[model samples]
Target: MLLLLSVCLIAQPATCRDEQIPVGGGAANAFVCLRNSQSVLAQWQDEHPEWHVEKWRCAANAAPPKKP
Candidate 1:
């Protein structure tokens, strides 16, 4: 099973992905993010004890700057 977490990486407004591993086995992907990555992930962990974070990453939502 593969888990993917896409949490905002840079210091900008972006998306985060997280993969949760079930006790039985296998992984699931979830997209979540708030002002803080740690806090958000922590909350998710607390809510779902049956699953553990496998991997995570940030998906940038910022667009490239326009050339002058």
Candidate 2:
């Protein structure tokens, strides 16, 4: 029971892809959901000024981003 609880505590939270809005003739960019914590998306936009990032929310059945 203790091990199971520990596993649950350390488990990664479910998330969905937060894709950037594409401009005219431009490709959309995908971002990982950091459990919607740390304002990571905002940070990414700040770091990459060229990309147009859109605000996104996670749904109940959202799947986490695939690892590269």
Mark the 10 consecutive residues where model 2 has the least summed lDDT. 1-10
Candidate 1 C-alpha lDDT tens digits along 1-68? 21224333333434344453221121122233323456556776777555555455433334232211
Candidate 1 global lDDT:
0.40
Ten-residue region with minimum lDDT total, candidate 1: 21-30
Model 2 regions lying over 4 Å from their true place:
1-38, 59-68
Give the lDDT of residue 29 in candidate 1: 21
**If scored against the real structure, what TM-score would every candidate get?**
0.39, 0.28
lDDT (10s digit) by residue, model 2, range 1-68: 00000011113333223343212221122223323323544565576555443334422222343221
lDDT of each: 0.40, 0.30
Which candidate has the top score in lDDT? 1
